[model samples]
Target: MTTVVGIDPSLTAAGVSTIKHPRIAGNPNKPICATMGRQGSNADTITQTAIRIGDQTRRIWGSLPSSVQLVVIESPGRPNPNAPGRFAERATVYYRIVEQLALRRIPVVTVASKTVKKWATGSGDASKAEMVAAMRELWPAALIRNDNEADALALATMGAMQLGWLEPELPCHISPNVSWPKGVVRV
Candidate 1:
């Protein structure tokens, strides 16, 4: 019963799924247990958000059984060019997660957003609703309230599939390398 936790990190809210890998067929990837963590409003600021996310991560880490083995995090998507300073903030959040997970000595893997989307919906550009619908098909009883949590679960599913805990359920598709249109670094 290896436990793998997938995290969808955000400044205000982070979605976490703790899955107990099962040996069952068809539903081999099902998470025997899961939960989500919400960082309070006061922690929404950039600096505070990083700290809160770290705290939330630590809390989740502490709660896991000794059998737990890996941690998977969805790499924050590249920031919008029109939004100044957003890239830095997003990168900050991502780095914080990686750093914390490393400190815990848990093997961490970062899955790209496009890869996750493609794996879940057959299209990297699929809408949140489309991804949610696909997840429902995979886990009929999964309570997918929002895109954040759904995205987190998708990352978990991908990680589980990669680790061989789950069967190869989705078709194999190669994800194109992420690229920026033009000189858009600080934007």
Candidate 2:
């Protein structure tokens, strides 16, 4: 079975999720979700930030199953003025993840933020609150604690839909309200 992993990269709280579907590969079961980030107020210097990002990336890479065939990550966009160095830090982390996955021969897919938002909430410009609400409504069982998890779920669902692994049970012409089975393993 092939598994798809979706990641929302961040130095503070990077969200990681995995969905396994043998049918997608014409085969059974597969699993995984979690947040990756270093916690420390003393991480002030550039080196410290880099180390933190590396640690987070390593954690995420280590957590992925060997069956992971595809990794979809939220592509980095313009820098956030409230968070200086965020763009560079996230870009480095993203590159590190891609490099590690490349070494393992696992393909990586970078989904645009707008794409995820549109897929999850039917609006490319949906706000964080909208995303959270949409995900909660779609998968009431999962505990979507914050926007990061919601985004991660959206990213995973987008990848699944793109791969034709997650066809919405509901009938729709364009993007439908899709949902995956519950109990996705988390670490």
Candidate 3:
């Protein structure tokens, strides 16, 4: 079985999910779905947050079967100007995840945050609550307790659909209203 892993990285709370492609054609099974994080007050330092994020990621990777072929992660956009310092801290956590996966030689794919949101919900600017609701409607078995988990699963689903391992619930294009040229719908 080939598995695609999705990660929604953050220092406050991160989401991890996986979709396994079975030998036979059928629904892709999401055998992993969870969030990991320690409160900022608990960590108190950026370095501590990075350590916790790395440890959590390692634990999740260790639990997986060795058949994981691709890692799909959200692209951490430019830090908010109003919260640049805080952004750096969270960005560091995201970088740690990418670095660890790269060290393991796992192929990492970055899907934009907006793209993941649109892929999961119908709108690119969907709220966190909307994302949660959409994911629940799509994958009823997934216990998406928070937006992070929903994002992870959504990114994983996008990767699987892109790889042709699973059919997409919506058009694969990031833009829902995109007017593709004739016969150029798939991305």
Local distance difference test values of all predictions, in order: 0.64, 0.72, 0.71
- Per-residue lDDT of model 2, residues 1-187, tens digit only: 3778888988788888777764653323333457767664655787777778878888878878887756778888778898757788888888898889878877677777887787777778999999889877766656777888888876776666656766654332145333323322121
Better of 2 and 3 by lDDT: 2
Residue-by-residue lDDT tens digits, candidate 3, 115-179? 77877876779999998898888788667889998899887777666666666666643343322
Against the true structure, candidate 3 reaches a TM-score of 0.79
Instruction: Give the candidates in order of lDDT, highest first.
Output: 2, 3, 1
What shift in Å separates residue 12 of candidate 1 from its native position after superposition? Answer: 2.2
- Deviation of model 3 at 163, angstroms: 1.5
lDDT of 3: 0.71
Q: Cα RMSD for candidate 3?
A: 4.8
Model 3, position 14, has a per-residue lDDT of 81
Steric collisions counted per model: 0, 0, 0
The numbered model that scores best in lDDT is 2
Where does candidate 3 stray beyond 4 Å?
24-28, 42-65, 172-187
- Candidate 1 per-residue C-alpha lDDT over 63-93 given as tens digits, one digit per residue, 9 for 90 to 100: 4556646766778777787964545655666
The worst-scoring run of ten residues by lDDT in candidate 2 lies at: 178-187
Question: Which residue pairs collide, candidate 3?
Answer: none
